[model samples]
Target: MSPGADAPDTGRFALRGRIVTLDPADTVLDDGVLYVSGTLIEAVLPATAPAPPGFAGVTPLDTRGSVYPGLIELHNHLPYDVLPLWQVPKRYGNRSQWGGSGNPAYRTLVTGPMKVLGQDPRLMPAVVRYVEAKALVNGTTTSQGIALFSNAGARRMYRGVVRNVEQTDTPDLPEAASRIADVEAKDAEKFLARLKQPHRLLLHLAEGTDAAARAHFQALQFQPGKWAITENLVGIHCTGLNADDFTVFAAHGGSMVWSPLSNLLLYGKTADIAAAKEAGVLMGLGSDWSVSGSKGLLGELKAARLASTAAGSVFSDRELVAMVTRDAARILRWESALGSLGAGMRADLVVVAGTHGDPYTSLVDARDEDIRLVAVDGVARYGSGRLMRALAPGENLEPVPGTAGEHVLRLDDGTADTIVAGLSLGEATERLAGALADLPALAATPVPPITASPGGGVRWQLALDEIEPTGAELRPRLPLLSASGETHPTGPGIGALTAAPAELEPVALDALTASDDPVFLATLAGEGNLPADYAGALARLLT
Candidate 1:
């Protein structure tokens, strides 16, 4: 969309209506507006701003509803099958006999036993894939999966989880530790490698206990930024792992996918929240699945918030929102694209209605039906029933499928050309960095040319552009750059919008033409988080 009269073509997008951008500092726009172009975020101004100039020719998408970044499910998967609780009891009739109790309380107890008793390993992967698909439609764009174990004899710790499967050590108790390490080793390797291609992978390396967790790390010869360690490799449900495992995860600088309810429901525990925090690991909360927990993140948030506080310190409502938004995006390593409402990122966004007092608490307590609209890259994917019906009577727009937008930018999807076609310089640069970063092999190598516009015309753009937090009403400044090598800085801000390829000066130029308030440019080459004298330092470099 073009900027309205009297406003500069800042290249940012405006979703209109209620816009929710999950930056770490928890900045939201009520009756919000977003400014996106190419793949960088130009600005996220309030709706009060007059439509920027040049918008006359641009097609305006009147969301007139809420908008949000695409939702991401960190510790989830594509399930092959989602059997009913009752189905499990009959399918593997003797599963309950392992505990010698057909009692419903031990339904979880039967999971390990059923699988350990020679269920084909090949089926597990497909079953997981099904669950992954379900999550996608539930506002989940990304999911995580752990290595699946085969039988009771696969891993010692896994046997311990379902000792009743083959109760050699305890009577009527599932064996938590089995000799399935060999099987798990193979299965884990396959699952991890599978996650590398196409699907965003979050490996749940549950090694039973802390001691075993450490040992697995050593065995895997894990190294930072090696062996398909894409930015999206999140560690999930890692309670049994010790400090060493945390260190290994930290050294890699990956995120942690926490499933508090599922953890408590199935294993009576969740990941070590305190340890995860101390390690600087980005923390993303999950709902697991209805099989083990509720599909709603609201419930997941309540469980994790309470659990995290008891296990550590109290977490504010904003913190809970972060777990689902900014922090979650960070863990996915998709902070540049999917998590926020900055310029150049996907226009995928969500909006809620009637939120007046507190956005975070309201969002945490938000119901599924409360979602007004969900867009995928600037287009509405899910429109509220009331809004859609009101907009076009007798028109029934299909809601977004769970996995509908997985690869929307691909050439075959008919949306290839439109990808990032309208982003600003800041967003464009960020998109460049994100796309290039995916291939660590190439990203690490030297490249030629430092031209700002690699896509030829300013309209041409690249993919990988689609994809933070706090609260307490903090004020921060973000810089804005214009087409004419000018920079305009805003007031106090939590994050900056910069350029990529380490050579373009678009952001600096943006600051020269931006508003009087302090503004900061974000860049790939730039160091992470510089609070003191940032705008001045950045200003000097860009100018």
Candidate 2:
């Protein structure tokens, strides 16, 4: 959904909770009451204040949690959810080496079987839907990535930030672009020109410590006289960037999206975030993909916090939260409607259980189990089964048990059924393991030998000169690059492609793969005070 456009008025209702409004000054209302009229926020008032005259009959949804703006994931590769924590034996010099013919795992696990599965039109959509559900369960209301599923003529199955239209064909120039290598000098000039208009250009720059990665940053830097606009640029990874590079990026108003966990796992190092912060370059958080990143944005937030702390330049809890909310929205140019909680803003909100006096602390420490509700456009799309029942009595709410014996609420939105259940930070990983266990045996392909030149160029060949051929036959599973000259798993590793055929039961498979539900304790409007035993109330609700 485009930012700020009023969604069709579903109806009016009130949500009362401890609100943490990410206003200019970071306001906190211990007992805040937000009135929603249709898709827009009608008012944000103290709970002690009287309700507006027109809201007399509307029921209030009382939550024992803190309500804030929905989290915005600025970067992600959603289809990679099928694979959990996949990596080679050792770090490669660059991303190309990791995915190229040089890596045996890439050839067998990803390129060979996975590629074959991805070609299946039926299976691809199921995989994409599962990834989206993972994001929603983690409290991500708005996420940006290459759209793999078509929602045309169907009710939007994946609720958060649906911008699926391919922008490459736009004559006026695309609103966003990615992958720095794809942009040549001419393309960069065109990108600069587009910056004059409303545009955002994202690139995977400085992703590794190798010279090739460093050169990518140089290619992205503005030439003294050739280019000038940098405000619309967003660089992802940036692990190899130095102080001078940070200075240049900040001077031009360029921002960066940090994937700390992915960076650390890939290169054993992350960006100089402290220097970037000091340079005044805005930073947003992202989970690169399931292969090298945490489960989702919530897990990524914890990783970012730990990384920052280890670097001796810790971000405040509020500042860390803003990185995924306001700061990210600003980068996406959706700040007006998506980031903060205020009257007239789009009602994209998240509620998480927290007992601390400081809401920021609770948010920082919140696991998926802490999240009680996540709403987009004034609709409660995901929450506990109990909350979903109260929010939309007309819709069917089914309880699906996760691997850990936790129940998740699964809802169907016409197009596809989505698991809106609360998941612990590690639940997705556990489910992914179970899903993979159902797969058939994957055939192994011989690893292609890679010869490196002194100039850092890699040459891949079927056989090396020093090695003698044995009686054993060798077969190359798939070409390193496809017919279109694109690498396998173009955006991210597609894991479901290689799974066993018998396990392709989409509905049943997803149900068995649902994550654990969170603890939820809420009172419907007009109810008396919360039960004295809050834990007991939550336990009863879960049962």
Per-residue lDDT of model 1, residues 1-543, tens digit only: 111122212243445665667776656677656655533344566766765554434333456555556565554322211322111221121111212223432322222212311132322222322333234324443333222321221221111100011122322111111112222233334434544454334455542233433333433432333432334455566666566656666776555667765555344456677777777777777665444444545346655655756675546777777777667656544566556676556455556555466766666555444556544444333445544433333432443322222211110112211222232223333333333233333323324222345444322111100000122111111122334534343222112122121221111111111111122122311322222343233233222
lDDT tens readout by residue for model 2, 133-200 = 66777778766543322212111223323322113222221346442222232244555564555567
lDDT of 1: 0.40
- Give model 1's TM-score versus the native structure: 0.50
**TM-scores of the candidates in the order shown:** 0.50, 0.72
Give the candidate number with the greatest lDDT: 2
lDDT per model vs. reference: 0.40, 0.58
Which regions of candidate 2 deviate over 4 angstroms? 1-9, 146-187, 225-229, 403-411, 414-543
The regions of model 1 sitting more than 4 angstroms off are 1-14, 35-43, 57-66, 80-137, 144-201, 207-233, 243-245, 296-298, 389-543
Q: TM-score winner among the candidates?
A: 2
**Model 2 per-residue lDDT at 538:** 25
* Distance from true location, Cα of 130 in model 2, Å: 0.7
